[model samples]
Target: MLDFAKGPILAIQEFFILAGQAVRNVFRRPHYGADIALQMDTIGFGSLPIVILTGFFSGAVMALQMSRALAQYGQVGRTGTVVSITLVRELGPVLTALMVAGRNASGMASEIGSMKVTEQIDAMRALGTDPIQKLVTPRMIATAVVLPLLTIIADFTGMFGGFIVAYYLLNLTPAQYWHTVWTALEWNDVSQGLLKPFVFSFAISLVGCYYGLQTTGGTQGVGRATTQAVVVASVLVFVLTFFITKIFVGNVVS
Candidate 1:
């Protein structure tokens, strides 16, 4: 029997070592410019197109669904509010994080795995370079800092998407939709959603970098690590999303 129990145990062990190494790397290497570039690339540039597409589609669908559900109650006007609020508070960050997990996290893992397999990582150590500080730290900081910004962009774009669907496709008056949105949303929901992405960013970066560092064998092992990194990072993000939502609902936004 393939022991699924072993998976979580091994993953937990790897997480601690990776996290400690990442912290030490931050103090030792201090590659400010590289970190900035990585942040820009991972959080901004790579995430932009996917975020836009997902935001638009999700907003449109949410509006349509809410409108259908509310029609029976003569509350179709609530579509904008529901769509806008949901997008900003949940869908935006969750979807953006998923996309980033698939894109940047997997790619980063693959790159690092290749480096490790090629002995480049070993060479760095031989030449007195700190692997944790030079590589892992910059990536960890980049994703951690950039993910929330991406989520914000996604939130705005998603709201805009709702506006388009409600106003044009559904023939809702612009004032009516805007008014509905303003009344139904609270600041706390937005705040909670935005804060959650930082946690997701940390998970993605840590999982990707850790898996990469642990890569072994040859090209096949690197490939497996990349796949595992993306899969595990995405699952963790969703789990965190659910937990954060629970916390937000129970305490913060209640």
Candidate 2:
């Protein structure tokens, strides 16, 4: 049992170690502004289409499904309220983070894992470069900066999607649908939505880097690292969101 528990315990320790070093690099000299910009473009701009598509559709579906339930209570007009609250508070952040994790986390693992097997990372270290500073810190900073922005975009697009459903299917006036959507959002909902993505960004970026840096066995190991990065990053998004929501729930209740 000790042997069985040791591997996971060690892995957790290593992950936190990597996280600390990456964060420390953020404040140190020789800032990789160009690399950080590149990662933002890659992780943020590259992800826009999917994030928008998913956000829009998720809101539309939520509005559609919720309309029926509201209709049962003769409250179909409140579809926008339900759609806005659900999308902003929960669905937008979770889905956007998952989409980013699937795309960038796997990409990070494969890119770094390939560099690892090719000895490029080793060569950097020999040249007096810290791989964590050059590689990990920039990615971490980029994700942290852009994730909240992306969540905000997702929230608006989702509300717009809900508006489309409410306007056409439910025959709600534009003023009515938009009014509910706008008013349904409290500061707490917005804060929770933004905060969840920011927290998930660290998990997604770091998990990928951890798996990539740990990769061995050459090409096959790269593939394994990529898969593990996506799986772990995606899982962490869900897990982190749950805890975040729980905390906010407690605050709201109080």
Candidate 3:
């Protein structure tokens, strides 16, 4: 049992140590502004299509599903309320983070893992370069900066998708759907929506980086790291969102 627990405990300890060093490096000198921008473009813009598609379809489906239930209560016109609240409070950030994790987290792991196996990271260290600052910190900053924006875009696109369904299939007026969408959002919903993505971004970036840096066994290890990064990052998104929502729920109850 001790042996069984040792590996996971050590990995978690190393993960936090790497995370701390990367975050501390954020305020240090020799800032990699260019790398940060590049990562932002890669993680943020590269993710837009899937994020948009997921948000749109999820919202449309939510509206479609909920309309029937609402209709049973003669409240079909309030589909926007259900769709908006669900998207903003839960779906938008979680879906976007999961999509990003599948795409970029794996990419980060593979890229960095390849570099590690190739000894490129060692070469950087030999040349007096800090690999964490050059590689990890920039990715972390970029994800942190860009994720909330992606969540916002996802939220709006989702609301728009819901609006389309509500307007056409349900025969809800555009004003009515938009009004409910706009009015359904409370500050708490918006706060959590934005906050969830910001937190998930760290898990995605840092977990990927940590696994990449830990890679061994050459090419096979790179593949393993990539898979682990995506799986862990995706799981963390769901786990983190649940806790964040719980906090908000507790606050609201109080």
Candidate 4:
């Protein structure tokens, strides 16, 4: 029992420590501009289409289900309002984070794990490059920057999807749907909507790098790290989502 318990406890400690180091490196000297640019392209541009598709479908389905529930109260026209709020405040950021975690986190772990298993990481250290600075910091910075942008795009796409459903299936005029969505959200809502993604971005990349760096047992270990990164990052997105919501919304604990 103690061994089982200690495993997760140690892992958690290592994760936070790694995250702290990465955070400090982000603002420090010897910044790897080229690597950061490449990672931004790899993480942000590469993940765009899937994030858009996920957002669109999520909003459409939200509209479908919410319409039925609100219809009983004769408030089906408010679908846009609810969909916009839900997407911007929760679904957009959370789902985008999940998708990125599934796609990019696994890739991060696999790539780094492969290097670790093959001793390439040791070669970097031999040449006096800090492995953490060269390998991990760039990824951490790229994901933190990219995920928020993706979340913002997802929020807009989701709102657009909701707009389409409202315009056609629900027979709402385009003007009415647009108006409701815009009016229902304020600057406070937008700020809160964005905060979750920023936090999630850090969690996903840090967890991926943490697991990747710890890889062992050769090829099989790389595979295991990849899978574990995805699972852990994805779970963290949801867990962080709740606490973030509670903190920003400020009524959950009360």
Q: Model 4, 111: alpha-carbon shift in Å?
A: 0.4
The residue-by-residue lDDT of candidate 2 on 1-254, one tens digit each, is 89999999999999999999999998899899999999999999999999999999999999999998999999988888999999989999999999999999999999999999999999999999999999999999999999888888888899899989899989999998988888888999989988899899999999999999999989999999999999999999988988999999999899
Candidate 4 lDDT, 49-70, residue by residue in tens: 9999999999999999999999
Query: Which pairs, if any, clash in model 2?
Result: none
Query: What are the per-residue Cα lDDT tens digits for candidate 1 across 1-254?
Result: 45878887877887897798776666664566766686568656877888888888888888888888889999887888898789878898899899889988898899999999999999999998777777778788888778898888888777778888898878899899988877877877778878888899888888888889889999999999999999999999999999988988888545
Question: Which lDDT tens digits does candidate 3 get at residues 1-254?
Answer: 89999999999999999999999998999999999999999999999999999999899999999999999999998899999999998999999999999998999999999999999999999998999999999999999988889888988888889888998899999999988888988999989888899899999999999999999999999999999999999999989998999999999999
* Runs in model 3 lying further than 4 Å from the true structure: none
TM-score of each: 0.92, 0.99, 0.98, 0.96
Taken over the whole model, the C-alpha lDDT of each candidate is 0.84, 0.94, 0.93, 0.91
Question: Which model, 3 or 4, shows the larger TM-score?
Answer: 3
Once superposed on the true structure, which residue ranges of model 1 sit more than 4 Å away at CA?
Answer: 1-10, 24-29, 252-254
Residue 19 of model 1, lDDT score: 92
Q: Which candidate do you rate higher for lDDT, 1 or 2?
A: 2
Model 2 lDDT at residue 12? 99
| Local error of candidate 4 at residue 78 (angstroms) | 0.8
Clashes of each: 2, 0, 0, 0
TM-score of 1: 0.92
How many steric clashes does model 3 contain?
0
